[model samples]
Target: MARPKILVVGAGFAGVECVRRLERELSASEAEIVLVTPFSYQLYLPLLPQVAAGVLTPQSVALSLRRSRRHRTRIIPGGAIGVDTAAKVCVIRDITGDTVAQRYDFLVLAPGSVTRTFDIPGLAEQGRGMKTLAEAVYIRDHVIAQLDLADASHDEAERASRLQFVVVGGGYAGTETAACLQRLTAGAVRRYPRLDPGEITWHLVDIAPRLMPELGERLGDVALGILRRRGIQVSLGVSVAEAGPEKVTLTDGRVLPCRTLIWTAGVAASPLVATLGTETARGRLVVRPDLTVPGVGGVFALGDAAAVPDLAKGGDAVCPPTAQHASRQGRRAAANVVAVLRGAPLRPYTHKDLGLVVDLGGKDAVSKPLGIELRGLPAQAVARGYHWSALRTNVAKIRVMTNWLLNAVAGDDFVRTGFLARRPATLRDAEFVDAYLTPEQVREHTASLRAGLDGPPTG
Candidate 1:
């Protein structure tokens, strides 16, 4: 008899964890595992800001999948374009544009998320994103290029626009991005004798009344103070009303001239969740406490794409989309999969919140570990230690630590790769806006595929 095939979509923290556990528990004769993802590595998202600041090399965060000891699992370098539940077939488009129909006895959906964007004019065309490794590197090179351009420009207004930088959203991503890249520019300015340190400005804007509201009231204030002390303009309760090639108009009726706009507002669940044709809460697929889809047999979802009920919190409370929750939920989802296969009782996922950490670059930071609020060097140490401990492999931990040490001793090398200099690295570009199917289209395509499999084409 052939082994049962288990297919997992995505290679993020959730999907990768699921695959690793399955590979460890199940024998090759019992089941065959397959992982589908566009990239060959699992990106360490939290350290992305450091990449933008050139503190860590890009390769440091992109942990390779080939390094895994689980040789039984077959890897497919592709993205799932559509899923037909009735046929139990997943349509995948590989990097080479070749399409394949993969059949599976069990399916795991963990396609992560894309940057949440609004309908603000010129935002999509002019704004840069920070979701992927490519985007981080692009932004770094782009920032350095701006500095080089500003030094050469004769017009004061043009130079001023080039020197100004704006980052939207005050969450972890936006806050760290502003803090790290601001430090990058602060140091890079000395290389350009013509550019004054005061000429370079960083503006952090968010619609929320406070920065990093998730960090709670006191720590949020602490983070705000650190950014303010670093000469960063923190604009709360306001957002960009409009964006142009060289200027952005704020909702508070202030127009600022700036060439760089890094948008980290938020993230929406991947469109793949909508393609599942299941019920959703706030754009995330609704999953049961065991991380399985309610009505879809043999299908499970987790991570940022699923609204898994937080059983620990009790009563309709869903888990927040964070790395800590995602990684834990991934393990739970895999265990439940094995339990179902063996007719064992399934366990519900329940985990308490593990506080939060924010590194504002340099010696300033804020964190609440085990319910204790900390700031300054102590907080920075805690933040780095937490991240270091959370890394999956020792190699990654060593590389990250080495990078930190080297950066501390020998300053940044403001070198530009110039990869994205000619092309626009907008949010849509990074997220592959055209890759997904709409909800209605998914239903229609699934129906058509099922019909085709049942009979011959009528036309």
Candidate 2:
């Protein structure tokens, strides 16, 4: 008889961890591991701002799927557009835009998430995002290009508009992006003899009452002070009402002339979740404590795609879609998959958050590890240490560490590399936002798959 095929969708932290665990735990005769994802690398999302600010190269954060300890995984360069639970088949749209169906005895859904955007006028077109590596690269180039144009211009009005930068969402991503990029521009202006350092302005806004409230009020204030101290206009309880080509209108009737608008507001679960036709809470699949999908046999879901119950918190509390939780869930889910195969007992998934860490660029940072507050160089060490230790490969760690040391000494050259071919500046182009299929399309594909294969296979 053929070995059981385990198909895992997504190559995010959760999916990658699941694959690594499965490879480590399962033997060659036990099962075949298949991973479907659009990208070949697992993006280390926490330090993405450092990539944007030139503190770290984009390659350092991208962990290759093929370079694991054991080469057991079969990687498909595709995105899972839909899952047919009854058929035990997943419809994947590959990088080339062709759809294919693969049957699996067990399925793991970890499609991850996309940038959460609003219907504000001109937001999608005029605004930029920091979600993908391409976005980070593009944002870096765009920021530098703006400085170049601003410095070259004799037009005071154009220079003023070009020098202004606006970042929406006061959460960790936005706060860090603003702080790091603010520092980047602040330092880069010293190279421009024609431009005054004070001419560069950065505005950070969020609908929340406080910046990084998850860090608690004390650390939030500490973060706020750091940004304000750096001359970044930190606005709370306000957001962008509209984004334009030349400026943004604030919800509180304030207009800021800016050429750059970065939207790091939040993330919504991948649209693939909707194609599963399952119970979902807040746009994520609702899974049991053991990370199994209810009413779906041999199916498990985790990460940003699944609302895995937080047994530690109890009472309908699903785990937050964070990398820390996702990594743990991946391991537990893999073990559960094995238990299912061997007719053994399964384990429940539960973990309390250790704490939060916010890197505020340079030697500044704020962390609440194990509920103990820390700041400055000490917090910076903790934050960087956690990230370095979490990296899966030695090369990634070495590159990141070397980049940090080199950047601290030499600083950013502020040179736009223009590494990405064609230079995709929009979020949809970079993120493949419209790639997922509808339920009906999925059903149609399932019908075609059944006819072609003469119904689902029995292994």
Candidate 3:
């Protein structure tokens, strides 16, 4: 008899963890594992702001899958476009635009998420995202280019517009992004003799009443204070009303002239979740406490794409979409898969909160570890130490540490790669929003494909 095929979608923290555990627990003769993802590496998302701020190189955070000890798992270099649940087939489009139907005895959906955006005007066209490696690199170069342009331009209005930078959202990503990039500009401006520190402005706006509410009130207050002391304008309970090529109007009726707008508001589950035609909460696939999709046999979901119930929170509390939760969920999902294969009982996924860390760049930081609040250099050390230890590979850790040391000693070069200068790196662009099929289209395509595979009706 052929071995059962386990197919996992995505190469993020969840997907990678699931595959790794499956490889370790199950022998090659027992099951065949396959991972489908567009990229060959699992991106360390939390450290992405450092890449954008020039504190770490892009490759330092991208851990390669080939380096895994589990060499038996096959990797398909593509994105899963659609899934035919009835037929147990996943439709994948490879990097070259070729399509293939991958059959799986068990399916794991962990496609992760894309940047979440509101219906605000001009956001789709004008805002740059910080979710992907390309976007981070693009942002760093773009910010440097702005400073260079402002320094050379004779028009004072144009210079001011170019110097003004705005970042939306005050969560971890948004906060770190604004803080790090603000530091970048602060240091880079010294290179421009014509540019004055007052001409450059960094504004961070969010719809929430406070920044990083998950960090607890005390730590959140510390984070806010640090950003303010660094000259970052923190606007709470507000958001961008309208964004344009040269200016953004805030909800408070303040029109700020800014050429750069970075959006880190939040993220939504991958559109592939909807293609499952299953129940979802807030656009995430609904799964049982064991991480299995209810009523969908041999199918599981985890990570940002799945709404895994938070057993620790009692009832109706689904786990928040975070790396810590996703990584643990992935392991539990894999264990359940193994249990089913071995005819053993499955276990529910549950975890305690490990606290939160917010790195505000430089010596300013805040963290609450094991309910103990910390700030300043101590928090900064803990934050960096946690990230360094969490990195999947030794090479990655070395590269990241070396980069940190070098950055502290030499500072940023403020060089623009010009790779994405002409290309739009908005949320839509990074997520490949155009490639996904509409709900109706997915239904039609799935039905049509199923019909073709099952053959014509009997006469």
TM-scores for every predicted model: 0.97, 0.97, 0.97
Clashing pairs in 2: none
Q: Write out the backbone clash pairs for model 1.
A: none
In TM-score terms, candidate 1 sits at 0.97
CA-lDDT, candidates in order: 0.89, 0.89, 0.90
lDDT of 1 by residue, 292-329 (tens): 88887899999999999988789989998889998888
Question: Poorest 10 consecutive residues of model 2 by lDDT?
Answer: 450-459
Clashes of 3: 0
Model 2: residues with Cα > 4 Å off, grouped in runs: 419-424, 451-459
- Candidate 2 per-residue lDDT, tens place, 1-459, comes to 999999999888899889999999899899999999878899999999999999999999998888876977888888888888877889888789887888999999988888899889988888889988889988998898889999899999889889999999888899999999998999899889999888899999999998988899999999999999999998889988988888889999998888899999998999999998999999999998999999989999999989888888889888887889999988999999999999999899999999989999998999999999999999999999999999989999999999999999988899998666345477777778888788888888888566666655322
Clashes of 2: 0
Report the lDDT of model 1 for residue 351.
96
How does candidate 2 fare on TM-score? Answer: 0.97
